[model samples]
Target: MSSLPINPPPRLLMGPGPINADPRVLRAMSAQLIGQYDPAMTDYMTETQALYRQVWATTNEATLLVDGTSRAGIEAAIVSLVKPGDRVLVPVFGRFGHLLVEIAERAGADVHTIETEWGQVFPVSVIANAIARVKPRLLAVVYGDTATTMNQPLDELGEICARHGALFYTDATASLGGNDFAMDAWGLDAATAGLQKCLSGPSGSAPISLSERAVAVIRGRTKVEAGIALETDEASPDVIRSNYFDLGQILDYWGPRRLNHHTEATSMLYGARECARIILAEGRQAVIDRHALAGLAMLAGVQGLGLQVFGDVTHKMNNVVAVEIPAGIDGDRARAALLADFGVEIGTSFGPLAGRVWRIGTMGYNARKDAVLTTLAALENVLRRGGVRAGTSGAGVDAALEVYEG
Candidate 1:
C-alpha cells in the first residue's frame, strides 16, 4: 500500500454538528499534557467545571466534563439516574429522541415514548398528559433534535415533571450555546451537551451538569471500586451497569474528593475548557442572538430561492434549518456540487425525512453573517445548476442580506 499523509482539505462546515471548532479552542488543545492529578491539571478541571456552570446557566455543583463524546454524557446521566425497572418517559421528535429511547432501554428503564410527526414538536399539554399517564421516574427529552431541525419546547415540561415528582433531563448537544437554555430556571435536573456544536470545539468531550436532586439519586447507587474499597467506603448493590459511564464515580473524580477514576482526556479537557471560556467571554445571550440572526438569514435565503422550509418554523432550532428539497432535483447531487465546487458542507435529514430535506446549520464558530450569506450563495448556484428555478441569480443572497441589514 502507498504511504498516505494526513493532510485534509479545508471546508466550511455548516452541518448539524462537528462544525469547525473555534480557533482559540484548537490552540488550547495543543498545550502540553500533565498528570491527571497534577495540581495544574486539577486546577484546569476546576476552572472547566466553573466555566461550564455559566455556559449551562446552572449553578449546579456537579457540572463537569465526561471523557467521551456527547453520547457518553447522555449515557452517564441515564444509566446512573435510571436504575433497572425505573420508568422513563421519552418524547420522541427525531433521530436523537430514538437514541435516548435506546439508551434508556439498555439501562433497563421501563421506557415510554410519546411522539409527534418528524417535522413537529410536542406541545406542553401533550407532554404533560404523557407524564400524568406514565407517571415516570425520569422525563428524558431532546432539547434540539438536529435530525428534524426542530427544538422541542421544554420550559413547561420541567414544572410538569416537578409536579409529578419526576427528574427532568435533556440532551442539548445540538442546541446549547446557540439557543436560550436556562437549566436552572427551567428546573432541568440533568442536562448534557457536546463541545462540537455551539460551543465550537471537537466532539471528544462531553459537558454535563446535574442538579442536587440528580446527584442524590446517583450517589444512592454509587459503588466503590474493589481496589479502593475501605471499611468506611459506601457501596450500593445496584451499582451503575457500566463502570465507564458511572456518573457517581466520575463525580468523585470531579468533586472535592479528587478520587481517581479514569485518566481524563487531557487535550479534550483543554479544548472543552476553552470552549466554555469562549462562550462565557462572549456572553451567552449575545452568542445566542448571533445564532438567531444567522439562522433567520439562512431561512430567508432558502425561501427566497423558492424552496419550502420544513417543520413548524416557530419551533425550529435557531441554529439549524430544514429545507424541503425542490422537485426534480436530486438532494444528494445538489449537496455534492455545493461541497465539490464551493467547499461548503450542509447536512441531510435521517429517518422519515431522509432524502426529503436538506438540513443547513449556522452554529458554533461558523454562525456568522458572512458564513450564512456564502452558504446561501453556494446553495443557489448548486440548485440552479440542478435545473431548479429561482426568481433571480442573486435572490438568495439578496434575501439574506435583507435579514442581516434589518
Candidate 2:
C-alpha cells in the first residue's frame, strides 16, 4: 500500500449544510495542538464560550461546545433535561422535529407531537393550545428545518411555555448566525446549533447554551462517572443515561471547576472559535442581512426560470429556499448535471417532499452575490438541457442581479 498525504477535490457546496467552511476557520484549525488543560488551551476554551454566547445571543454561563455533530447537542440537551416519563411536546414541521421526538422518546420521555404540513409552520396560537392541552414539562422545536426550508417562529413560544410552567428548547442548527435568533430576548431556556450552516464551518462541533433554570434541571441529575468519583462527590440516582452526553459534567469541564470530562477535540474547538469570531467581526446583524439578500436573490432567480417556490414564503428561513422541480425534468439527473458539469451541489428534500422540490442554500461562506449568481446560471443551463424550458437565456442571472443591484 502506498502512503500518501491526503488531498480533496474542490466543489462549491450550495446545499443545505456542511457547506464550505470559512477560510479563516480552516487556518485556525490548522494551528498546532495543545494539551487540554494547558493554560493556553483553557484560555482558548474560555474565549470560545464567550464567543458562542454572542453567537447564541445569550448571557448564559452554561454556554459551551459538545464534541460531536449538531445532533450530539440535541441529544445532550434532551437526555439531560428530560427524565423518564416526563411529558415532552414537539411541534413537528419537518424532519428535524421528528428527530427531537425520537431522541426524547429514547430518553424515556412520554413524547407528544403536533404536526403541520411539511411546508407550513405552526401558528403561535396552535402551539399554545397544544401546551395547554399536553401540559408538557418541556416544549422542543426546531428553529429551521432544511427538509422544507421553513423556519418556525419562536418569539412567542418561549413566553408561552414559561406561563405554562414548562421549559423551552430549540435546535437552531440550520438558522443560527445567518438568521435572526435571540436566545435571551426570545426567552429560550436552552438552544443548540452547529458550525456547518450559518456559522460557516465543518460539522463536528456543536455550540449550545442553557438558561439557569435548564442548568438546574441538569445539575439535579448530575452523576460523576464511577471511575472519576471522589468520596465527597455525591452522585444522583436520577443520572443522565448517556455517559458522554452528560451536560452537568460537561459544564464542570468548562466552568471554573476545571474538572476533566474527556479529551477535547482541539481542531474542532479551534474551528468553532474561528467561526464565531468571523461572524462577530462582520457584525451578526450584517451577516444575517447578507444571507437574507442572497436568499432573496436565489428565490427571484428560480422564479424567473418559471419554477414555483415551495412553503410559506413569509416563514421561510433567510439562508435557504425550496423550489419545486419543473413537471417533466428528472430532478436527480438535473442535480447530477449541476454537480458533474458545473461543480456546484444543491440539496434534495426528504419524506413527503422527496422528488417534488429542491432545497438550495446560500449560507455561511457561500452566501454571497457571486455564489448566488453562479448557481442560478448553472441551474438554468441544466434545466434547459434536461428539456425543460427555463425562461429565456440569461433571464435567471438578470433577475438575481436585480436583487443584488437593489
Candidate 3:
C-alpha cells in the first residue's frame, strides 16, 4: 500500500461514458452520510426525480432511481414490463438490443428481434413493419449504443409503438445528457438511464421513467404477502416475479408514502441529483448543442486526417465517433502509446468491430474544444509514430478548430 502513488495522472477521458464527473456532483456525494430514511435524503430523492423529468423532458409521475449501474435499470424495466408468455420486440442494431432479448428471455418473455448490421440504423418502416407483424407487448431499444456509437431514431418508432398498443422503452445510458431526447413527445412509455455516461458522474445510480400506461401495467401485476393481508390490502394485481427489480415497489418508495425497500444509496442519489441539476442549470438544449458541435468538430478533424468513419454518418450519435483504425498502424500499440504519453483515453470498438475501429467520445463536460483538440492531437501523434503519413499530426485539430471558428 505504501508503494502505491498518492497522486495519479490528470486523465482526459474521451471515451464512451463514465466520463469526467462534475465537481458539484462529487462535492454533493462528499457530504456526510445520512440515513436513507432521513427526511432530508428523501427530500433529495423527490427533488432528484423532478430534475430527471426535466432532463428527460417529461412529466412522467413514475420517474425514479434504481440502486445499481445502468444495466440494473435496463433489467428492472425489462423484467417488470414483460411477463411469462408476453411478446417483446427488440430492434437489434447493436449490442444493447441483444442484451434486451437476453434479459427478456430470463424474465420469461417470448422475445423477437428485428436485427440489423452493427453499423446500420433500421429504417422507420423496418421497425414499424416488425411491430405490425409481431404485435408485441413491449418494444425495447437502445437510444445510443457505445459499441457502435450510433443513435437510433425514435420519433417515428414511438408513433408506431403507440399505434400497435405496445410499450416503448429505451436505454439512454450513452445519450441522455448530450443528445436531444423528449420522452413524452417521442411517445416513449418507458426509459432507463445512468449518471455515468453523458451525465458526467459515477455508475451506481439508474434513473428511469415510466408512463401512466406502464405504471398501470405493473400495478396490475403487483404481488402480495402470505400473512400481511390483515395489515395491508389485497395482493397487487401486478405481481412481479422478481422482488429486486420490481418497479411497482420502487415507485411506491419514491412516491408520497415512503415505503421501505433497500436503503437508497444516498451518495449516489445526491450524485445523480447534482448531475441532473448541473444539466438543468446549463439548459438541456444548450448541452445537446455543445455535444453536437464538438462531435462535428471531431468528425471534421478525423476526416481531414484522412480517416474513414465506420458507420452511417448522417444518423451518427452526437457524442461518439467511430473510425477505421487505418492500414499499417498497429491499433493496440497506438492506443497504448496515446494513453501512456498523453494521459488520454479513447475506446476501442466491440464484438465484430473490435480491433477494426476506434471509438472516441465527446460527452457531457468533456464535450469541449480542449477535449476534442487534445484527443485529436494525441491520436495523430500516435498514428505518426506508427508510420502514418506526414502532415496529418495536427490536421484533425485544425479541422476541429475550423468548426468552432465558424
Put down candidate 1 lDDT per residue, 241-344, tens digits, no spaces. Answer: 78789888899888888878899999999999999889888888999999999999999999999999998999999999999998999999889989999999
RMSD of each: 1.8, 1.7, 2.4
Question: Distance (Å) between predicted and true CA of 46, model 1?
Answer: 0.4
2 against 3, candidate with superior lDDT: 2
The TM-score obtained by model 3 is 0.95
Please, what are the lDDT tens digits per residue for candidate 2 over residues 191-271?
A: 999999999999999999999999999987776643365344344436688879999889988899788889899999999
Off by over 4 Å in 2: 225-237
Question: How many clashing pairs per prediction, in order?
Answer: 0, 0, 8
Residue 263 lDDT (model 2) = 89
Worst 10 residues of 2 by lDDT: 225-234
- For model 3 the local lDDT of residue 247 reads 85
Candidates arranged by TM-score, highest first? 2, 1, 3
Q: lDDT for model 1, on a 0 to 1 scale?
A: 0.92
* Model 3 Cα lDDT, one tens digit per residue, 119-144: 88988888988999999999999999
